[model samples]
Target: MNNPFNPSFGKVPNIFLDRAHAVTKLSTELQNPNSPYQTTLIYGVRGVGKTSLLTDVGNKMSAKKNWLVVNLTTNYNVLQTLIDSICQKSSPEIKRLLDKIEGIKLSAFGIQFEYRLQELTETNYQILLENILDKLQAKNISLLVTIDEVDPTPEIKNFISLYQLLIRENYQISLIMTGLPNKLSELQNDDVLTFLLRSARMELSNLDLLSIKHSYQDTFAKKGITISDDVLIAMVKKTKGYAYSFQLLGYLLWEIADKKITLATLEQIQGEYLATLGRNVYYKVLQELSPVDHSFVIAMAKAPTQVVTTAYLQQKLDKPKNYLSMYRKRLLDAQVIKSPARGMLEFTLPYFKEYILENLKFYV
Candidate 1:
């Protein structure tokens, strides 16, 4: 049977686990133009399923009556790209509105019809989008803008500003974006887009262990693979409740398994695929940290035990409690680390501590 595990980013998984409440709530909000979550920021470190949640929410909303999903990419001229996307995916009724937008004519033709159509400027992309939004609003239709991989880019800032204006005009639209914690921190500094700070925030975290266990078993059984309970538990433990690792482990294990998945089958996967999964998911998370946060993380990794307290970290790094507190909040916001108690900290990703120890020299 083909491997059911899909490790690629942004692609919705075949066996999605957890985040049901959040997804359902966001889906319901699509019908309410005034939902506070109408402009939401779904953020987390790499491989935490931010894109999956964002995409799933968009898909659910698109299925609703008279709702449209406009997905944006990190390309030149975000406004122009948005204009083109709305034009392309819009219903015929909406298309009539987009057909009147000016500058987008130059963008849509991409020099192919430059001779027939006069070159136009994109300064009024907001006007174009507002016209489209007003037409849809009249028809009682709404638009949901889903953007992935947010960064501190000029085009993105401009896009946010434009959205702000449309919101003031009461166009029926919602903007959902995903970004790393640090990138989002910087983006919020833009005075014009500072309103994003008030937007609802959904920080993606690891899946529930029970959710992973059931989803894993169900997916495997459907493929005619008899997975023992012990092996199933071991697989979930190795995945660390991360969505990406869940897919990676299952894909590798299925590649080598016969009709049954035994304890032996789980053992067969450890040497190479396990390390590959760690590097793919864990290292990228480390890169997302700021230099100070990275140093703080390395200190926690070198600590004597899995759980470290703020006092212990302060002593280990010879820093003040205030300094540790600041980085702690930063890491927590990034979802790279979690606080299990009043002051105790632990890495959120499974096998992450082990990975840190093995690469301490380079990271330090």
Candidate 2:
């Protein structure tokens, strides 16, 4: 059998685990005509599966007959990308409508047309988009715009501002954006994007160990493989409930093991596993953090124990307790660290503390 596991970041697994509820919630909202979640943001650290979740939900959403899912990336001009994606739709009806409005034949055959009227030659994006929406909504269709790894640039802000206007006019549209906490936080500071603050916030948390273990066991068994109980437990523990690691471990193990999982195989892939996490998650996360936030991570790393006291963090940074609060909050917001107890702190990402220690000189 071909490999069922997909380790590449953002590739949705054939069998997704630990996020059914969020998917169900999004599905319900997509089907509902009036959903406050129309403007949704899925925020998480790298490898926490924001993209996977977005893909899953977008898939479920686009399955409906009246819904159009436009999956986009932040690589290009956001507005132009949206326009290109919409125009690039292969649906016969969508192509027909675009051609009818633009007075240009756009289809697989070839582009051939001229303006039937002088008035049709000049059309703005807003008018063209609104006309497209009007045509779709007239047929009781809704648009679902899903953007992965969203960057909150001026272009994105402009897109949000325009989208907010569409919402005010009661357009049948929904937007789903996935991004790191730091980039998402930038949206919160933009006055134009204030409408987005009211949208549903689904922060990706660590997958539960129980969910991870059951999924691994069931998926392996389906492929005619039986993993020892201890190996299953060890696999889940090593994954630390991170979503990408869940797939990464399974992919690595499936390659080496014949019919059964072994500890030796687990030990064999340990270094590549860590290096993958560093390349995929750690570097991306640190690249987005400000200097102050890096200092906060370094200070926390210097603490003697994993559970560092808040007071100790302040003293180590040689800053007043109140002054240190900003960085502390920044780290907490980024999900790099969590307040385990009332006053205790610890890194949330598995092996993050080690990654920090190994790269302290650069960050400091």
Candidate 3:
């Protein structure tokens, strides 16, 4: 049988955990004219389901008759891509209206449009987008733009500035963006993008342990397989309630287990599980950190408890309290580590300490 669990990034899995609350809140707010959620930002660590949650919310809104959802990526001119996406998804009547605008020609190749200009200025792009929004508004259609993996680029800043203007003009337009915490922090600090600081921020957290357990039990039962309570709990604990880990462990378990799961089956996948996570998530996470940030993380990894005290870290790194405090706030803003209480810190990703310990030589 095909694997029911999907460990791939950005792809929604067959047996997904229900984040109905987040999905509902965003979908409902976007439909409301006065809701502040019209512009929402979702930020989280890698593989914590930021992209998946954004996709789910977009899909929910797109199902409505009056909603036109357009997904954009940061790899190109965002404004041009927005126009192309809007035109592609628009109805035939709306397409004709947009095509009638001078200098904007809709290509016969699936509604992609070309602007007759050597270079499109910010003002020019805004005017073109305003014209299109006018057409969409005439049909009483609300536009929802979803951009994944947002970064602080000139293209993004330009698009966001225009987006703010469109919002002020009271167009039936909304934007939802997803990015890593550090990337979002960078965007938030941009003077031109200060409007983003006011956006409704949703920081994705780890899944509930109970929820993860139930999802596993239900999924295994559907496959006519049974897992003892002990073995099931052990498997769930291994996932650490992180979304990607849940899927990865479930995918591995589904492939190796037969009609019944035993502790032995769980034992078989341990090496592969940790190794895969290191390659897919941890390595990339480390690459994003600076040399000092590496030292901070390494210091925390040496703590006996998952939650490390600030005093302990200060002593371990042999840095002054003030010096360590700067890195503490930096990591907090990056969401690499979170403070569970005053003068304490902990890694946001599950099994991160173990991953660090296993690869200590390279990091050192």
Candidate 4:
């Protein structure tokens, strides 16, 4: 039996995968002999297929061309680690290059090589990199380095500086990176990174409605499960084009089906079940908040509708009106709520909105 919960790393064929057009275009560009941007950055919101897309692209690039692809994800210190990982990937060549450089000691034992950058100045390091890049270029092997979750690392700034230097001096290596939505902003604030940002920005394609439907139908069909159009539409509506949510919903519904999902079972999913899911999700989000903010969240959750007014919440939470903005900023930083319109705030997690509404009394 095929696994419906494909949250794992490996790509599954015949599964409900989308983003073909975008992947194809990226493949073409990366493989292009004349392609300019040695480094590319792909950005999107979380669970929007960023990982899947990069995985697919990396697989394609590695299999077809002489591209040396390494995909690494980092939550912190990505730049130093990225350089270290890349140097590790190029270890054999690094050993060979260091061997050739006078007064440098290089030794390789088993799969590990120990060396000292102490004997080498920054200029020597740059020269060694250039020599390795030339050797790689000679072999027609472009180093495609991809780093995910790049924002948390301060080293990213340094890495970008080094990468821009390599590009300026014409290295054959290329980079593809993805991270939190605000990462680009962080990168752009620096002068060198601002220059690179303009040169190498590549946007990931979003899944369209048709792609969503096709993916749902295909995934279910593979499992011998079928869902009605109405149920499919509802799932799509709830997911709001989020790729992970779509996969999560599909996986959950497959379990709910227990055999074959039909129009009946689809419609049979009660609001209670949805509300329960929402509550669990919202509760987890609440766990991250302080006691006071949690109370403020409860007040907002107790409201009947999606739109929560500041005046009403202030009165309910017994906070002064002037403090609303402060509360709002705190929640915003915590990413609990987003202000869609002026004076109107909504939970970033829609399911949490439902969760809070039904479970507010318990928490309160």
Candidate 5:
């Protein structure tokens, strides 16, 4: 049988788990014109399924008759991409209406819109977008713009600023954006983009262990593979409820095991699993951190307990409480670590401590 689990980054897995409620909540809010969740922000650490959740929400909204969902990325000019996506995805009638706008020209090849003035400004893009939105609103259609991997680029800031204006004007538009927690925080803290601070925020945490076990059991059973309860629980704990780890571990197990799962097979694939995770997710996650942040995380990994106290970190780094607090907040904003309780901190990623220790030479 084909492997049901997918470990690739940003690709939706065949066996998705633990995000149905988020999908439902966001989709429902987008459907309601008066809902505050019309502008939603989804943030999480690497491998926690931010992109997948955003795609799912977009798919749900797109399935509705009146919702026109346009999926975009922050890689290009977000405003132009949105305008183009809207033109392409619009119904023939709506497209015809948009084609009537001065600068927009619809062709069988694709949308070709131009600025009447040679020098284009933010106002030009805003005016053009508003015109298209006007037509969409007239037809009682609501626009849902889904942007994945959001960054605080100038183009993104401009698009978001225009989005806020469109919202204020009651254009029947909604936005759902997903990004790494640090990047989203940067955008929210921008003086001009402060409106995003008020948007509905969804931080993708770890999946529930019980739910992961049930999913693994159900998936393997469908393939007629037998795995005992103890073995299954062991495998689930190995995943530590991280979404990508769950897929990666399941994929490795399915490939290595025969008719039944055995600890022997799990043992055989352990090195490959961590190595692949470091290459795919952890390396990039580390690259996002500053050198000081790296020092702080390494210190945490050196601690004896899974949870470490702020005082311990302060002493270990030989920095003052204020200094440790600054880095702590940085890591927290980056979602690299979490405060389990007052004066305590823990790595948010499963197996992250081991990853940091094993890769210490490169960072040091």
Candidate 6:
């Protein structure tokens, strides 16, 4: 049984309803006459289709609104990349104007550099921005620039600064950015950006239970499979509505789609593979851990609720365990799990918890 929803894997067209709603709202905001937002920030956990929704919005807006879209994936030299992006689509007169300027012919990494007086100064950037924007406006072309990875650090700060300047100058440009939620707080604190970010914050939270259920049902229905409610609920509970987890499980379930899935067949997974699939993701991360760290995780797996205190880990590892402080840091660095507040941690990957518990049941 092929998955009906599998086509959407790693593709933008398969965006779910919940994510579509978010994109639609932003689109509506962009086209709104009364209170249009100049900049939009979309924040969500990894693999929640932030990029996909933006792609869908961009495609639709391109057709319906004739929007000129510029998408920038945050990478090295992002600021200059943005400058090049603007130049690529600048008006012929603007391009001709930039071309006549001296020291503008140089290309780095296969991109032509544009030389304009205001390109140098923060003050002048605004003056130059108004000129370019005026030209763009003359053509009745609105711009929607989507920048993924909203971290307000080095690479992004430059773009943010320029955009903030444009906003102050009242340029007619719409911006949509996606990144980790933590970065949103970072932007909210910036004096320059705070005023500009009045009401354009869109948070992409996890899918609700009903949405997840609907997604699975739709996927199975497309495959001509009738999944039982109990099996469907089990899958949802194990995945906890995490997008990537749902995809991975859905994908694997499809691999076994020869017949209708039953609890009995699910229980027949070879050896501990099924029990450990839930935990394998965690240990896949764990294999990268040091021996001491690995032992500590094994301890946590054996523990209830998958929670471990520093003292508990110390006792489990049989050393003073203060030496294992680096272990926690490394685990976090590896994104295995995170401490919610302090003194408590949960598996970042849900299936890992079940994997660990199953290991304890079989091996211990």
Summed backbone clashes in each candidate are: 0, 0, 0, 0, 0, 3
The residue ranges of model 4 lying beyond 4 angstroms of the native Cα positions read: 8-16, 33-37, 75-125, 200-206, 256-259, 262-303, 307-350, 355-364
TM-score of 4: 0.70
Q: Each prediction's Cα lDDT score? A: 0.79, 0.80, 0.86, 0.63, 0.87, 0.63
* Residue 314 lDDT (model 2): 78
lDDT of 4 by residue, 1-364 (tens): 5556553333533344567776787788887646654566776545556667778888888786567777766545443344345445654754465345443344443222223546444455555556556767766668787776566355567666777787777676777777544566567666657775565565543356667787787777777776678767776776655455566566567667765666566556646446544443445556647788887787777787788988778778777877877878777654567777888887765366666666667676
Overall local distance difference test of candidate 4: 0.63
Ranking by lDDT: 5, 3, 2, 1, 4, 6
Superior candidate under TM-score, 3 versus 4: 3
Among all windows of 10 consecutive residues in model 1, the one with the lowest summed lDDT is 110-119
The global Cα lDDT (0 to 1) of model 2 is 0.80
Winner by TM-score: 5
Q: Which portions of model 5 miss their true places by more than 4 Å? A: 114-119
Worst ten in a row by lDDT for model 6: 1-10
Clashing residue pairs in candidate 3 (N, C-alpha, C atoms within 3 angstroms): none
lDDT of 5 by residue, 110-179 (tens): 8886765664566777788899888888889999888888888988888888888888898999888889
| TM-score on alpha carbons, each prediction | 0.89, 0.90, 0.94, 0.70, 0.95, 0.68
> Tens digits of per-residue lDDT for model 3 on 1-364?
6888999988767766757788888988888899889999998888888888888888988899899999998876777778878888887888899898765887678544355465466567777889889988998999999889898888888788888988999999999999988888888889888988899999887789889888889889888999989988998888877889999999999998889988898889988999999999999998899999999999899889999999899889999999998989888877678888998788877788999988889998
Q: Model 6 over residues 57-117: C-alpha lDDT tens digits? A: 7777767544567778767666555556766755555566554444444233433535564
Give the CA lDDT, 0 to 100, for residue 84 in model 2. Answer: 56
TM-score of 2: 0.90
Clashes of 2: 0
Error of 3 at 72 (Å): 0.9
